[model samples]
Target chain A: MKKLINDKERFLSDMLDGLKQRDPHIEIIEDTVVVRKEKKSSGVALVSGGGSGHEPAHAGYVSQGMLDGAVCGEVFTSPTPDKVLAAIKAVDNGDGVLLIIKNYSGDVMNFEMAQEMAEAEGHHVASVVVRDDVAIDNEEQRRGVAGTVVVHKYAGYLAEQGASLDDIVKKVKEMMSTLYSIGMAIHPCLVPTTGEYGFDLAEDEMEIGIGIHGEKGISREKSASVDKIVNRLLDELFKHTDSSRLIVMVNGMGATPESELSIVTKYVMEALDDRGITVSKLLVGDYMTALDMQGFSLTILDEDDEVLEALDADTGSKYFK
Target chain B: MKKLINDKERFLSDMLDGLKQRDPHIEIIEDTVVVRKEKKSSGVALVSGGGSGHEPAHAGYVSQGMLDGAVCGEVFTSPTPDKVLAAIKAVDNGDGVLLIIKNYSGDVMNFEMAQEMAEAEGHHVASVVVRDDVAIDNEEQRRGVAGTVVVHKYAGYLAEQGASLDDIVKKVKEMMSTLYSIGMAIHPCLVPTTGEYGFDLAEDEMEIGIGIHGEKGISREKSASVDKIVNRLLDELFKHTDSSRLIVMVNGMGATPESELSIVTKYVMEALDDRGITVSKLLVGDYMTALDMQGFSLTILDEDDEVLEALDADTGSKYFK
Candidate 1:
């Protein structure tokens, strides 16, 4: 595996060190959680996290108007409850704290454990699960993908607006209902710890509906043109939402070139325009990424004026913009 | 080779279409150039462009405080003089325009042609060539690589401050003198049009001092750990500058993961700290990229108070932040 790393065991800590060094707005705590250096001190603090590989997701969102703290774990591994509790304690103000947990089995369990621990300590904490990935037919099995970032933005904006933790949870849950995401991969990523490829694929094949951690997708087929692939993902996504106006995110799996992402973005816009769906806001880039996975994901959120205002609100995030 | 493209011939145009659709801040002109939608009406307009593969370079930098226009060519091919002229005319609002060209033979020839054409039409235009790559010992042969984006930010800031085209040119040239960059690649990228790899590498080999176009670098050696590789590149870059305070950018060639880039940023910070050099500012991510190349480049600029202010200035660019 050709990867730029040293001592695979130190990957997470090393990455976090680099992150804190690059941005002054965030500081690392408990050697695993990243929190805003400037505490909110008044409004409800928004906290989110999961595995570490999907970067700029949990930690990258830890900025003034976004996440207050992000509890990071090893690559594709959930953080312990203690680490999550540390993040809660570090960011929670008098207003309370909200946890934006992606709907992964490991993540949900650990974050909930942390919530219970924090509540036992007299901290008021509410948690919301983002199950936006539409690859699976069962809602319970849906895995949150790139759409989780929108949850961060919305929840962060609400918290910044002085919304109660309960109100932020309610609004974020409402937004999550309309969020849908689907991904396809041309090549699978190699997990650094095990030195294993997430999955195997032939040169001319692609996997549709792949998850961020290289989980198996819904189908594997001969690779087609960009439009066909984008349309296929959109078809699955359209079934989950009927909203005419939407916020679209074209997120790259770790290794896809920006040029190719732009091509994917072009076809996505064209496909949406054909369906008469108006894209109220569009973001195209690698926001949440799998480690060295060569693919892209399409995420769409039903748009309302409030959500648009929140997304457009200014933030101190170095990555979100 | 696997790629997410339709007709290789339409790569540039399709990517441009997507870019224009995704961002409202910039508009496409002459079917090849990207210019600001809200053009600056009374200040010197900064314009930059070159080949299409290195994304978020010239085009992504087109925004309120950055380049007023970006002329894009076919992948790895210099844009025609006509497109550059169109960008120059479209953005020049009588206060004159400045061209920021990278140091490539084809690019220098084409942009100069455009400048001559614009000058003949009674428009004031000044141009600066960035030769920051330290891989090549000959000053004239040094390629621009990723440091050109710094030029855009600096020049853009000056233009926003109402600096004359001549003044912008002089200051940018001065800044360019202090800029230095070096890169290393683990694997070469595939060219979409020709369906060929830029270069061949053995399983455990890497190329050092590679250019953005996958051009031959200074050396090829057995792959090593991230820190050693980073130190090797830094050694070459440090030979060109001796400033105690610096601004650093660790840029990814298209396919490197954000996780690896963070690790690189960590080592870079440590190396600078050990040398007693203070990093005034640091940017870590894929800023300028070669299409699907798996590697990174490090760029350091000798920083002064004026340079720091310019780098910190805000812009409407979707990619720069």
Candidate 2:
């Protein structure tokens, strides 16, 4: 592997160490859970987690006005139920806690187990599963990708506003229902455990409708222009929703450069404008990544003024802020 | 080229379009300049610029408390003297403007000519040329790299505090002298104009003491572990300075992932601790880039509490905030 890492065994722990070193306001618990240094005493604390590779997601979002804690698993793997339960116990204040789960089977099952375990321990816990990827035809099989961060932002905003756990879960589910994300990966991400890529693509070819975990995409084709790829992605996205306005996130799937992301944004925004759809708020960066995958994802969140406000609300997370 | 560009000729303009679309408070002038929508009239306006591909540097820093204007050239090329002159004129309030020039020969010569032209037009202007790289032995010939952003942050904070133009220049020059940086590239960055990488490295090799513009480095070796590579870079950097405290930036040279950047930060912070150097403020992200180079640079500024506070100050720029 061409990755800058020590032992593959220590990748997660070492990464968290690096993350903690950069942000003084974060603390790692038992080396698997990241919590805000000063946990708020009231309201529903937001918690999210998944595999370790998609950085600045669950952990970077752990802060005030965002997630209170993130329970990280190893790369391309789900955290244990014990770790998730520990994360819940760390950040759950008097009101309760909400867990945001991406729709991968492993993550969903593990986070749900933790939720049940936490609830049995007399802590009120609610969960919202994000299945926002429209690439798959079956809703039950759709996998969450970059749009999960938007769910975190909106839920964290509502939770910070002192909404009840039930209300936060309801609002988050509503948002998730309307949100859609689709990715195109030109290269597969490396798996540390195997020291190999999850998949492969030719130097001059591309895959459309890819997922975060390097699952088989909808189709493969010779590398087309970015504008054409964007049009294809957006055409798929626009089919499922009639919302006239959207909150957009043009997220890099790890190794894509900001220059390319900016170019992608230009084309995406221009295409949307040409279609008479207004983008209320747009975020362009590498918020959710697939290790070193060379691709980008477009996440469209159907939004009104309130949803846009929620997404734009102030957050203490270094990445989101 | 594996770039997400519509036309190579329109790359820079399209990028500015995307940037402006994302942030409504920024505006483009003369097709190659970025300026704050509402220039503050009472203080020294900060302006900086160079080549294009370094996204979120000169242009992204153009905001209320950071930079008032950024004059951009085409990819990897310096802006023309007339464009620099236009930028100075655009942001120069009655209080004069400060030009932050990276120490590339083309940039220094062009910006100096612009300064002369602006002064000839009766506009007071002062320029602080940054040459913070420690790799080059000849001080007069060293090129500015990522450390230029630190100069910008510190000087911008001081300018926002209403410091005199002379005082700002003096303090900035002092900081510039104390600042040191060095980078290692795992792969060469592709230049849009040439549609090719500036240099080549084998898959298992790396270049040490590299420049942002793809100038050859001091040495090349088989790709050592990140920790060893970081130690070598810091070894060279420490020989030139004896700063007790540092404000460090672990900057990605374009396509480096945040995960790898975090790993680099872990080793760097550990090394600094081993050397008894205290790091007050450490930022780990892609601030300055060399197109899509898969490498990183370490920038250290000798800073006390005041300088740290200056770096942590609020800015209207979306990237820095």
Candidate 3:
């Protein structure tokens, strides 16, 4: 797989043209598939995206407190609805837009066909659909990986501080009923147009709920140790956590190690401080990655403290502050 | 080789106790290594560190514009000069301390014995050392990986605007004569307490330069093509580049993939736009990583335009904004 790409679907548009030629106030939108392009305001507007092998998912998280537009789909595929109706008409703003979707099934039927073509272009749209991954315990075919990095940072930080689209889809399904994310792969993520590899796991094995386009994992076993893989992903994120409004992410299935995500955030913070559970915000790294693919993933949310102070706000990223 | 560690010589002091419990403005001293007690301002006090397997090197880069103190060591081991003289006496003030250090040999004789014991406790110490690893081009052991992340982001933005100690050691040795860095590797980088993994290479092998602790690599081959390893790391970073101030970076040798660092920044931006070069800031993902080691590494850095707008600042890290 000798790559340096010029074509191969312009690897995420030449890595978003080297991120808008290294940030000239970032704005990218050729045929809409996002990373915020401007002309946004009036209210609502928080369109997210998926699949482009999650490089800075939903477009390096759009910006200005998170997402205003993003609809890519060619790394794990699922963005057609005319590129989510050109990212809901380039971040709609006649006051109404909120797409944050992630519950797979072709990203919930292509964000419900771009929310019925942005309600036939009359704007006003709404959709939350996150089904955060609890591996698989019949949350009706549970899937959607890494809770779309916390629904693109709390519905793009409440649609950039002007929340609307029904209060940003009612606080993103009220933080997706206490969000939960689970992952683990240990290795298997190559998909540069079938350079093969999307599932393997052998040197000691591991699988858990794998599926960030590499799918495959209900269990696989053997890989053990990192507190037995964070106590089997905190026993399915504390069996769908509810109160104890926590927010711990120990991600990194993009070939793990920020010193093994601080040793899986010290065993998911000692299994959420042995259940007395307090954790307010703590994302260990490789936010929802799965490309180089080794393994890691745990994502509990159930947060109050306003989605844990907007997931400890302040962000830019070379590895999350 | 499985670890979530409780011991491995207390994995860098339980990762500075989960990085000071995920930031209570980080302050950890215990088994005496150091990392300041956050907001203890007293100006010109920018110390730095080495080794602790470089996770967020120099302790998640200290903070408040950046780095007042940081000394870590064990894992690649180097910290003792009484822990860089307790990080230059926990960030000395009266406008003096600097340190930075990275040209290894036990981090230049333990930051030159913590700058002669902070000039025999009178302070006003100075140091600099970062020999910007151009893959050890002999002339002396030549080490110091990933141009020490641009000398801790330009010596932590010039010791957060105070800049003294011989003008932050003459602009960190003019950023080590316009830095160069190189790296590669593919497999071989374990050492989290001898979990082994140093030089083995094979599944399509690779290796070139490689050092950030899993050391060993001047050149090994057979895994080419990320444009022949970005044309042999831009032919050893344009051999001491003067291609009119380049700045590149690619990085991610901690299990590569920001889509293979955008295919090594698309053949390092078509070999620095076919050598007419003029980068002015580029940086790709996984800066200074080696832990989950798969491979990558480019780092250029020539600089100008006020050090390329502080390497085009604005960072928090979803893998370098």
- Which of candidates 1 and 2 reaches a greater lDDT? 1
- What is the per-residue lDDT of model 1 for residues A114-201, given as tens digits with 9 covering 90 to 100? 9999999999999988888889899988898899898898888998898888888888888888999999999898898888889999
lDDT of 1 at B170: 85
- Of the candidates numbered 1 and 3, which has the greater TM-score value? 1
lDDT of 2: 0.87
DockQ of 3: 0.14
Best by DockQ: 1
lDDT of model 1 at position A6: 75
The DockQ of each candidate is 0.79, 0.67, 0.14
Q: Write the per-residue lDDT of candidate 3 for residues B189-261, one digit (tens) a residue.
A: 7776887887787777688887878877887888765666778777887777656667777777776666667
Off by over 4 Å in 2: none
Candidate 1 vs. truth: CA RMSD?
A: 1.2
True contacts kept of each: 0.79, 0.62, 0.36
Candidate 3 chain B worst ten-residue window by lDDT = B312-321
DockQ of 1: 0.79
